[model samples]
Target: MTANFSGDNSSTDLLIEHRREIADLLQRIKNRRLQVFGLYATPIALIVTLLAWAGSKIFIWLHGDTPTAVNSVFAAAVFILGVASVIQGLAEFGSGSPWEDSETSVRGLKLDLSLAEEKHVLEARRHTPPVSDRQASYKERIPGEIARLRKESRHYRRLHLLMQWLLFISSAAITAVTAWYDPPQPAKGALIGLGATVTIIAAAAGYFKPRERAFNLQQTADSIEQHTTALELGISPYSAAGEEENLKTYAATVEGLRAEQRMREQQLDQPQQGQQQVI
Candidate 1:
């Protein structure tokens, strides 16, 4: 009897340790995700500032001596406007609480599991609803959340595209005004037009291309929520055990999706960098 009791205690300790390990892993993944999101605004901010400064210089060169003070004020206003746009973009990109959103889903699953475990321990609990009912509730909430996230993503994408096009149009208009007044030497005019055309094309492509990793991360989170609910309700018996398995699956899927997204983002960055290099 003594040996049997000792064996039981040891098994219980091992289970506790495993649970702690899983929790740690999940926390690490979440931290990494938050860090990645926080850094996303930096590059856009730099680009906006650089473009504004370049545009201002071009305007000055084109206008020459006429209304010098007015031109300077206009150039300063354009720079300020560019800075404001960058600030606005950063706020929009980061304001959605993506990390919080993901964490909320994870917390919901954890709560359900904790309640289920507590009921199992109590044994005398008679009013507890069946797992199936709990699962159904989860499923009902998930689709709405997924739909909301998809809508928001689409809206932001469109907004970003609009901003890119607006920047290109503004740049072209400035260039045209400058050329009309200053009339760049034939060779210079040709080069300027070529450069502006290339920049616009590059920006358009970057804005429209699918952000593979971000899309993947979002889908993975949704899938994890769905699977967690299914597993808890015994509607779908996954290969792995408990909430930990669901979390692991979700993290793995997110990592894979993020990798692809990062690759695409890098590709987008390259063309912009190349353009800057030429300038």
Candidate 2:
């Protein structure tokens, strides 16, 4: 049963190709997770500050002329939270790259792939049922990637909902304060601050386009899922004469999907026009 297969060149090249693809997938997963973290974390920080400030205001109303310790504690909490929100937003926007950790993993994997010699690859091929096993492995990879994108899309959708709530609540509060209270100078300043806060949040939402991004990612993931399902069912392009032929179809189609996903990710990374200042 010893068929004289192309020994080193073709097999090694194929291994390298799959390794690079998996590396790219790892990178995509990492970037999307970081994107979810930053997108949601910034808003959570701001929301915490709002809640704490409201609580402090209620405390002041209930017990007028509070002690210095109480005032100092509230002031300190606000300061810390404000600083945290600013830092997180800056890190997310343009100040830092969140993909470094994933890139490190990719580098290590590539090194291992490079070290794989002809005999080593050949031995692996000899031991394994080549076409079916490799096709199954490839099939396994697609779902994980699609799930990652879908998960990130869910996070962004939640964020979009929360931002809408923030905008409405802030607007309502400002309107209520204006109608109900003939505010003193300080109260007027507070009202103005609330208005500014609402405006900034709205601007950020429009600039960031989390809703749109969520929609786009979800659509992309769905498209990938469809292709993967078709391949699994031996439909259309995936209907091949043999296991090897089908494997080629599967690999090529998956690579095309991955490239499309990468392009979408690049679009996600770029700041949309007219949003630069807000960004």
Candidate 3:
């Protein structure tokens, strides 16, 4: 009876350990999803508010001094939107809450760690007495799990693209309406120039959306690979002789790539900041 109790206690301990690991892994996944949602949603909201402001301003300027209560209300609404956008952008920029892409990488690491732990547990279970086969099917579905994650990532990318295009369309429409209402003349050259600048910015954003998505996807994938390799090396005790070395090499390569990307982003952002300052 003592031996039976000891065996049951060991089994219970293993079950508790597994459950704890699973719970941690699930929490990381939830956090990652939230981070991605915030990344896309926050930017889109700001862009829409900016476009509304720009559109209303252009309309008011085109139809000067004919101000009715409706126009005043519309202008107030646009001003409110602009103020809200500034607040939201400041919050996002200051807190860096929504742009927490690193959290996704952390979650990927947790998943990889969970997987390695699972492998260790399975090996231990195999060496011990027979257990039920219920968990085997779930383990076998890892490919499906990966596929689902990839699909979700792609969906987020598509949503980001859609938002970019919508911003571009709205900006373009505003510019077009402004030009139609008051064509380019020497007297209103400044207004025409402002409209042209807005249109150009919108066009550039639309053009760059695909490139940005590609870059972000590559970065995210590289992060996942690095995290996975690190977790595998850290957790798996019985890996092949060179597996640890390989993982280290993989991680180093990914880190180098990420550093290069950061440098490039900094270079790009500097000029944009300078331009904004000048403006």
Clash number by candidate, in order: 1, 0, 0
Name the TM-score of candidate 3. Answer: 0.32
The digit string of per-residue lDDT tens for model 3 on 146-243 reads 35545655865776676567666656666666667665454366555555766765666654454454555456555555455454555442244664
- Ordering by lDDT: 2, 3, 1
True lDDT of residue 192, candidate 1: 70
lDDT (10s digit) by residue, model 1, range 69-142? 75576567667656755654454455664443332344554565576456444532432344554444454565
Name model 1 segments beyond 4 Å from true: 1-128, 183-279
| C-alpha lDDT values of all predictions | 0.56, 0.71, 0.57
* lDDT for predicted candidate 2 compared with the true structure: 0.71
Sorting all predicted structures by TM-score, with the top scorer first, yields: 2, 3, 1
Residue-level lDDT of model 2, residues 168-235, one tens digit each, is 99899988888777654547977988899899999889778789889887988888888777877888
The local distance difference test score of model 1 is 0.56
lDDT of 1 at 214: 42
Worst 10 residues of 3 by lDDT: 130-139
Question: What is the lDDT, from 0 to 100, of the residue 249 in candidate 2?
Answer: 75
